[model samples]
Target: MLTDNQRGGIIAGYYLGHSCRAIAKVVGCHHSSVMSWPPAID
Candidate 1:
């Protein structure tokens, strides 16, 4: 599971037009991690 910071970073990255890999890099996680964000966010 992701920490609060990771979850928030992914959301911010998505809104900022960052790619999955880029979001992972910024959030200090793997690209697959972005795929697991809360379903409500999708």
Candidate 2:
């Protein structure tokens, strides 16, 4: 599983306009995971 820092990295990258696939590649997770971040983060 990815650490919070890793997940935050994915969220930041996505917020920067990076594609879900790109964020997933950098964060080592599936693209679908991108949808579960950002908004779900508290």
Candidate 3:
């Protein structure tokens, strides 16, 4: 599971034009996880 801070970072990274693979590296998750995360953000 991702922390609130990590989820926030992923969102920020996504909007900033970072790739899912790159964001996943920073957050320590898989690219697929990153790809699946945005829609579920709440």
Candidate 4:
């Protein structure tokens, strides 16, 4: 499971126009995990 900080970073990175793969790299997670983030975060 993702930590709250990881999840928040994913959400923030995505909304800041970062790609899922890029966010995943920064978050140290799989790209698919970033892609799987809920749209509600957008």
Candidate 5:
């Protein structure tokens, strides 16, 4: 289970143009985990 801070960082990193693999590296999670996040609502 990801902490709130980890989830927030993933979301922020994604919006900031970081790739899922890159965000996973920073967040210490699997790339697939990052990719599994819900699509951003515009």
Candidate 6:
């Protein structure tokens, strides 16, 4: 599971127009995880 901070980072990164792959790299998760985040997050 992602930490609260990581979740926030993911959301922020997405909103900031960063690619899922790029966000995943910074968040230490797989790119697929980032691609799957939107439904789970917002």
The numbered model that scores best in lDDT is 4
Q: For candidate 6, lDDT tens digit of each residue in 1-42? A: 999999898878666444665667778876664465555443
- Tens-digit lDDT string for candidate 2 (1-42): 999999888778667545555567788886564545455443
Query: What's the CA RMSD for each of the models?
Result: 9.0, 9.4, 9.0, 8.8, 9.1, 8.7
Better of 1 and 5 by lDDT: 5
Which structure is stronger by lDDT: 5 or 6? Answer: 6
Q: Report lDDT (CA) for all predictions.
A: 0.63, 0.64, 0.66, 0.67, 0.64, 0.66
- lDDT at position 21, candidate 1: 53
lDDT of 1 by residue, 1-38 (tens): 99999989877866644455566777877656455543
* Residue pairs with backbone atoms closer than 3 Å in model 4 (clashes): none
Candidate closer to the true structure by lDDT (higher is better), 4 or 5: 4
lDDT of model 2 at residue 26? 81
- For all predicted structures, in order, the TM-scores are 0.40, 0.38, 0.39, 0.40, 0.40, 0.40
- lDDT string for model 3 (1-42, tens) is 999999888878666444665577788876564565465443
The runs of at least 3 residues in candidate 3 whose Cα sits more than 4 Å from the true structure, single-residue gaps closed, are 18-42
- lDDT for 20 in candidate 5 is 60
TM-score of 2: 0.38
| 1-42: candidate 5 lDDT, tens digit per residue | 999999898778666544665577778886564465545521
Evaluated against the true structure, the overall lDDT of model 3 is: 0.66
**Whole-model alpha-carbon lDDT for candidate 1:** 0.63
